[model samples]
Target: MKVLKPIYFLLALFLSFYPLCSRGEMSAGDYYIYADSVNTGGVISGGDYGVRGTFNESPIGFTTSTSYETRGGYQPMELGMKVSASSLSLGTLSATAIKTASADAIVWSDAGTGYTLSIGGVSGTSIANVSDGIITIGSEEYGLSVSGVDRAFTNDRAIAERLILASSSEPVTNSKTTLTFKASISDTSVGGSYSQAIVLTVSGNF
Candidate 1:
């Protein structure tokens, strides 16, 4: 098979999120009864703190507001994610053709609101990235695209500081996102077996 002009890359996946609302206590049988948001609604100074509460709602006589029960028992927000691979090898760079590579990330979250996934260059890069959101074969260009819901990188985009790849507004399970990296080079482009390092971070919105 004709290999796509591929670049070598090392990647790292980090899983962490800010619990914006409640603090999680030790897990009890079912409910998170501790550290889960201080249930006090008052203006300590000029800051107005909103009250957070969990309840069992009924659709019979109400609109059945569900956000209040985001964590299902109002438990602390939770999230998990995994990358399918840690490295990508795009055989050899070509001057007359484009090369592509891809990797998959599966994420699950119970943060009530949802989660965010982003990619950023860990350090300097030798191959310049395409900033115009397009790849041309006659120039040395590198960029990335993504396939999934709430994707910010749906089109070719340069790898910048914490570039968001995808996000969700509601809780999701087994949300799989595929990231495709594309590259091109001209006859005058530099030739070498170089590798770049990047990071994928997933954050939950609790």
Candidate 2:
């Protein structure tokens, strides 16, 4: 049987916003109002210490992390995602032999609190998501592995439910996540031309 498998990945993105403070405020005991002999401003940094900025008693959106860097000014909420190839093809299938293919997901986001990456199997035939498993040919297995931060496909998961594949807690510029798809077939497994369609949706966090 000349078994050929192709998986297509589609990209989608969006942005979100949080309620902004009506007015900014200053933290307690913080010298938010500095009047220097030569200059004066609402903020000042001295020695090796400084402030991260204080606004209304308002809170950070979604979550907070000291490990995450902060950016000043109004940066338009932005997100971009693309797959190296719209489709990944696994040549011919051989019994007891695993066929592997890979695609790269490049993402760029400037949204506060970073962004999320999710994937769902829009369509498939003769193959199933092996999510976190190694494809065993004779076993007729199919699955994938994602390499990058916040790897979420660590167990058998329903790809039809649009599961989060990976994420970043901080804005990323041209970040790359590699998705390696593995598949195998059995001599007894019914197969002809196999194919699957996947949609990868990227949305910015608050």
Candidate 3:
């Protein structure tokens, strides 16, 4: 029997907004008050210090058993975020699988034959199609659909599309979300080492 080693990479990107306010000095006047002196502070001054967001983990790992072809298992990836902005938007998540030795390799091309990625265990915001692996939150697939690929990992071929992992109209602080990846081998799958990279990004709207 051949041994199969599959690696998964997780990367998170965060975008925050910080605004500064100017202070004005008022003097005693008749009807309307006029400011004799005004002081403008530079950006990154006099604002919320803890208004940024972060992820709990980096380069999240996943390992499959030797008998993954017969029996599949779940790889759980937990991610956390905190934002002080009035609104938040989660960007699309993408994945690209490549053979360790070969740049062009195809695993499971047939539909519903390779692997399925899903999202669950969310806090602070609501998500749709939690386990379906289809488009739900933004406008595209919520998770990756592992199908057989004949080319290298490129932007058009590697993207999962509109993941929309999480969002909020109000401020969300220290919230957690989990991604569950289930892998399996098809009849055409070869025995070797395989790996893939997953990227996720978060942005805020003030």
Candidate 4:
């Protein structure tokens, strides 16, 4: 009797287990991790020297030195620098000469006739041991040229068109002399960055 009762009990237990493990009706849900987060970041920046050109608004003047071997004393000299306005011009903006003040004499040697006038570095003209002076701004040349106007009369000359020199009391000597070159700048002159070096070489018979 007990064995017959156990058979029905076992059948009931199987039916209950089947419903928990395998169901005909569908039900769904997502499971995920719980999280807390933090984040961080950074940045950087920097500048420098820019491109520039030379602006010789006024006469830029300086001097060279002269030394004598068996000289009794020393002498001072005078040299003239002239700015030539070449045909090159960007509209009304033209290139002008920047003349530095008189520098000391650079001596070379004597030709038996006289002392040879020499300079360290100079630009502009074709300088000989006896002739014109060469004053340069970087690669720019400054020699004698018509100020784009007439020097025949003073009144006809304009500032932007000529370079005027002050009155001189003496000629070039062994010592250094003051020299100035004047010019007129235009409103149309290009505005921006600039830089340049000027070199003046005065050569003559001392």
Candidate 5:
């Protein structure tokens, strides 16, 4: 009986380890909401202020000349935005991309309308519903600053270069893309001033 008991214990131990050894590993399946970390890529394209069209300093305010690239690392990239200020009230707002001198410089042609800055959302995702909200600051409301703020409202009717992905048609896969953002305030009444920094949050599977 003692010998039999010892054999039974040995069999039980082997059975316990057999399943573990034969266990199957996991496999990533299709259509997964892959929560990949934020792999930051690319620097902002334009930043040097130039006088071109509208101002005595030049029509173009500050032009960011750098083209943003995808941050090195993972996939399934998504995009988000934030404002440097809690609120933004301004004048004739507008945004434009920096044009290179090269006649054949292939710049993005589809400059969608500029969208509004949110606490945590995108301004324009659809072509028809592009609205960054227009604000008319009277001469009295000049230089109005807001806090907890990290974004601003733009008069420019164009999509932010950073939020503009390489493929907006569907499941975002491409990682190597350039982006930029430019804005200006021309509220004549009070000599308008824009407040807050606009920061973007890009995330997705990577």
Candidate 6:
């Protein structure tokens, strides 16, 4: 009976460990599918991913004569511009001028005698819009109305106050636009060689 008791104890121990060995030998597929059901929670929302974008603008190539000879009459000068823009908001173009002297005195000490600079243009882009009337800048206002068409350009220090020569919300790639700057001087104006630096600015929103 003592020998039979030892044999029975060994049999019981083998039976207890048999189920554990079977569970450890489970296949990879069966273990993953049956082990706690892998709660994915649908899309697994988190801030680990994101979306982004970018924009670019090419230098506005302006071509024109370096000097102009205004012989006391309406002397018209022209410059051409080609714009390449990648933006979602409207692209804007403007020009502002600063004389060597003052606005009223293109030539020093010449009160009430100065040359007038005006800008105008026709857009090459079909969807682009140009100013149609005299756009005012600060206290000064100028007109670019010519030939029954009101293609005007405003002069101001503020970019918001400046005129929009050409604009469109869509991207403009190498769009050709012609800008005509007409300078008029009266015969009684100062005799010195007067000059003004005209600054052209272009911007696009993204």
In candidate 4, position 14 carries an lDDT of 88
Worst 10-residue lDDT window for candidate 6 reads 100-109
- What's the lDDT of the predicted structure labeled candidate 4? 0.30
Please tell me which predicted candidate would have the highest TM-score against the true structure.
1
What lDDT does the true structure give each of the candidates? 0.71, 0.65, 0.28, 0.30, 0.30, 0.30
lDDT of 1 by residue, 93-149 (tens): 888888989999899998878888987456656488897878888889888889977
- In the range 65-145, model 4's lDDT, one tens digit per residue, is 475333221223234433232122223212453433222222222222222222234333221111124333322322332
Give the TM-scores of the predictions, in the order they appear.
0.63, 0.59, 0.26, 0.21, 0.26, 0.26
Window of ten residues with lowest summed lDDT in model 3 = 98-107
Flag the better candidate by lDDT, 2 or 4: 2
| TM-score of model 1 (CA atoms) | 0.63
Off by over 4 Å in 1: 1-75
lDDT of 3 by residue, 1-206 (tens): 12322221111111112211223322233221222112321122123331122223332354356765322222222333332232222322322321111111111212222222222223331222224433332332222222222111112111344334334333333333333332333334344433334444443422
Tens digit per residue, CA lDDT, model 5, 119-179: 2334422212124432222211111111111223223233334532322223322222222
TM-score of 4: 0.21
Which stretches in model 6 have alpha-carbon errors above 4 Å?
1-161
Q: Give the true-structure RMSD of model 4.
A: 33.5
Report the C-alpha displacement of residue 199, candidate 1, in angstroms.
Answer: 1.3
How many residue pairs clash in model 3? 2
Q: Please give, for residues 73-132, the per-residue lDDT of candidate 6 as tens digits.
A: 111222223322221221222234311111110111111221121222222222111233
- Estimate the Cα RMSD of every predicted model relative to the unseen true structure: 23.2, 22.2, 27.8, 33.5, 22.2, 25.4
